[model samples]
Target: GAGAETALLLGLPIATLALIVKNIYNGMFIPLLCHKADAYAEVGDTRGIERMHLISGIGLSLTLGIIVTVSYLAGVNMVKGFLDAIPEFIKHGLSVATGIIPALGFAMLARLLINKKVAPYFFLGFVLMAYLKIPVTGIAILGAIVAVVMVNMPKFAASQPAPAQGASHDDEDDF
Candidate 1:
């Protein structure tokens, strides 16, 4: 019981940290990249970013709210039943992990509002960290680099015109 309580306590801070890191990576960095790539113009004013933030925040809250509600209704009893069938340690671990899901959802919503590119990185990083047991910080850094590189590479490729596009009819016939 004491261990479970302690774990729940620890999970709060870890979840908060995870939320903060995810928000910064998605909301700030990815948006900057998108702006640079001309995928979307700068909000033009602080109000615009604020408006986007408000709209996105509300949208995210509504979506997650529904998901959480459904999960509680459909999953709580099922999970309890499953946990009852499992070992005590596993049940404890699952309970602790479940508390972090809300924070993770919030972080995901914040990112989605500001930068859509973050979803893939978040999912991939989450899979790598949770399943593959990769270091979270390292994977986060790697994901950032990969996102930046991938976002910019297409721009670089697009800047180079094909020779065929520049060739005259005579040159085309010669080829």
Candidate 2:
């Protein structure tokens, strides 16, 4: 909903709008179909499961096809104008939520990935991007290099020869 609202607010190109619509349709409808399919599976109805898959596949394809066809026929301007009647506050709220969506996604991902060992590097990348203004590609490359070096460090240490077992260290012997 926020995505669709954002699309309408920004008046994105037809392709982006159509993609957003398709994604929304899948996100809403696919899970519903899956839930029903699960119930059918519990009853051992294999045909129902097959039918559900067929319906979902064809429904999504047709939805995308229809959206593309109708939007092209109607023109983007009409679609853009279609949202003009909505209240300003609702649009503003959706815009704010859309802005926060990326941060929320990153936070969820970090919850899964940010363990003690990984925390320092995660913050390092954040600082590089947020404060140092380095691009993501540069940070990713740096991370890869660091990871390679860290992984091979133990091997490098192991390759070095050990000291002699009974080396004399007396001062008189040295003199």
Candidate 3:
């Protein structure tokens, strides 16, 4: 009863706040932060951009809503069946872990998106850790280390000088 009452009281306000934040971020922050040429060229004007953002936001919410609803129902059924079949100790372990996996997934996605350097190797390392049966704590440490190392790798090639126009080189002659 408390949970239901709380959800009833807070849900609408929370949803409203989320929509406001989404609109502000999409309309103002993203445009300012993204490449000016790309944003303006694609959207044409503020009104057009706003419309695009609104449509996209609605579509994304609709899609995610359907997916999450289905997943939650399926998970509930599967978890119920599992609890019935499994030993008490294993059921308890799984019950505890069910609360953790979503948070872990969110953290992983945030890390990958915010730190582009780690994005490439993060999934690969995750697969390797899972397949190799590495302990969860070990996987977390290794993931962090790999992400840091990848993020800090030098951009030496980007800083290299370009050849001058009309400059002749032996490599070019050979080609």
Candidate 4:
């Protein structure tokens, strides 16, 4: 019971740290790289897109490698003082961080998600989870199905030729 309580208490801060790491990397850092790729597209430099992809791949691999190495070190107590220092101050440090991390996470998300185009989708997913009780796996599969359908849907309206100057001013006048 004590161990379970301790585990539950510790989980919040660890999960908060994980969320911060995931959001910063995915929402902020990755987009910066994607923006760089878009800059290349601006100049018609297709190679820059490929280069960004390569850089991102390398970066992701390096990050994972470092994480694995550090985790292994921590697990076996090979990191010595660093390993010992964590719990020495976890109550002081992580308790504060537990509150701060979500604030920071929401700040980051406000920038990323509170936009006109994206907010609706965000609320839709939130509703699906909060009210409808759709599982995340089901939502993801449903999203993918919708995405596939949307992508493959015809663009006849966009592809259609504009009416000749004399053909019809009727539709334009209504607008």
Candidate 5:
């Protein structure tokens, strides 16, 4: 609950900033970087590439770290005061946007996650958490096991189907 509350509270402006950064990275910086790389390649400058890579990685990491640190410091008191200074209608609009953004994120995830391959795991996790009263630790362990099995050993799936709806006689005491 604390994490959720913190996420909801902090997600609004952070999400906005992230979108801005992503757009800039995709639209501008990426092209510039690519062009620079191509130039280095054209000139047969092998060392340039290594330098560019180092610069790119360090640049982005430092930028993000600074932003995070500064944003966190500002959010400690200044951002709250700044928010308080906004008009009532603007504040109301911000509240609406904050609520809608998470829903939008969920919608996007639902589109990606509710597919055939993933649905069974989702349902299994849901049932484990909701119906079977499994602890978070148990469900996490099971999810990890399932993930490993799915990735490394497709034979497990072909050989034995996890019982329907993840409900089975053997798993009754797993909680």
Candidate 6:
């Protein structure tokens, strides 16, 4: 999923190579080798587990070597042609989905975190970015500063004790 999304954003031969590597390692090898290893572990077959591990390492090494060799031999034009064969609409859709996914993640996080007390700061950040046109990095720094100050304010306030109850003004002033 990530490789495919990044392939659209990058449109580089490396991205295609990454997609192929991920498909092989994650899609094929993980299910094929790792699941069998899990079965071996469950059965208390130490020899079987060891064999699986050795096979997994060798298989992964061979896969990587073969993929790198093929990709190098195939050259950029082949990768580019492969990329070009993908429909424009699909490319646009993936781009749009890529942009929206993070926003949805943020919204989900905000739903859990935001409350009456925190809402003001949330709006403040939104206003800073929307109205003031401050960049996100600037807003993040400002937010950090505000957080530090807010956290320390009570400590600073508590550091100085209030004058003793019913103390004379002159007695307090004498200190």
In TM-score terms, which candidate is top?
Answer: 2
Q: For model 1, which pairs clash? A: none
Clashes of each: 0, 0, 0, 0, 0, 0
The predicted structure with the larger TM-score, 4 or 6, is: 6
lDDT of 3 at 18: 40
Task: Kindly report the root-mean-square deviation of model 1 from the true structure over all alpha carbons.
Answer: 16.2
RMSD of each: 16.2, 6.9, 15.9, 10.2, 12.5, 8.5
Off by over 4 Å in 6: 1-13, 16-73, 84-93, 167-175
**lDDT over C-alpha atoms for residue 141 of model 3:** 86
Per-model CA lDDT versus the true structure: 0.61, 0.82, 0.60, 0.68, 0.72, 0.78
- Lowest-sum lDDT 10-residue window in model 2: 8-17
User: For residues 37-90, could you state the per-residue lDDT of candidate 1 as single tens digits?
Assistant: 343335346655555566556655565455445544554455345335657785
Give candidate 3's whole-model lDDT. Answer: 0.60
Tell me model 1's lDDT, rounded to 2 decimals. 0.61
Show where candidate 1 strays beyond 4 Å: 1-118, 165-175
The Cα RMSD of model 5 versus the native structure comes to 12.5
TM-score of 1: 0.32
Model 2, 24-127: lDDT tens digits are 77779999999999999999999999999999999988987887678767776776665555578966765686789899999999899999999999989999
Put down candidate 5 lDDT per residue, 85-150, tens digits, no spaces.
Answer: 657895576568768989999889989779888888888888999999999899999899978877
Q: Model 3 over residues 68-151: C-alpha lDDT tens digits?
A: 455344544443443356467854655576578699998887866756765665676677677987787887788788667666
Candidate rank order under TM-score = 2, 6, 5, 4, 1, 3
Largest lDDT belongs to which candidate? 2
Question: Model 6, 141-167: lDDT tens per residue?
Answer: 999999999999999999989977885
TM-score (C-alpha) between model 2 and the true structure: 0.63
Give me the runs in candidate 2 sitting further than 4 Å from their true place.
1-20, 34-62, 85-93, 159-164, 168-175
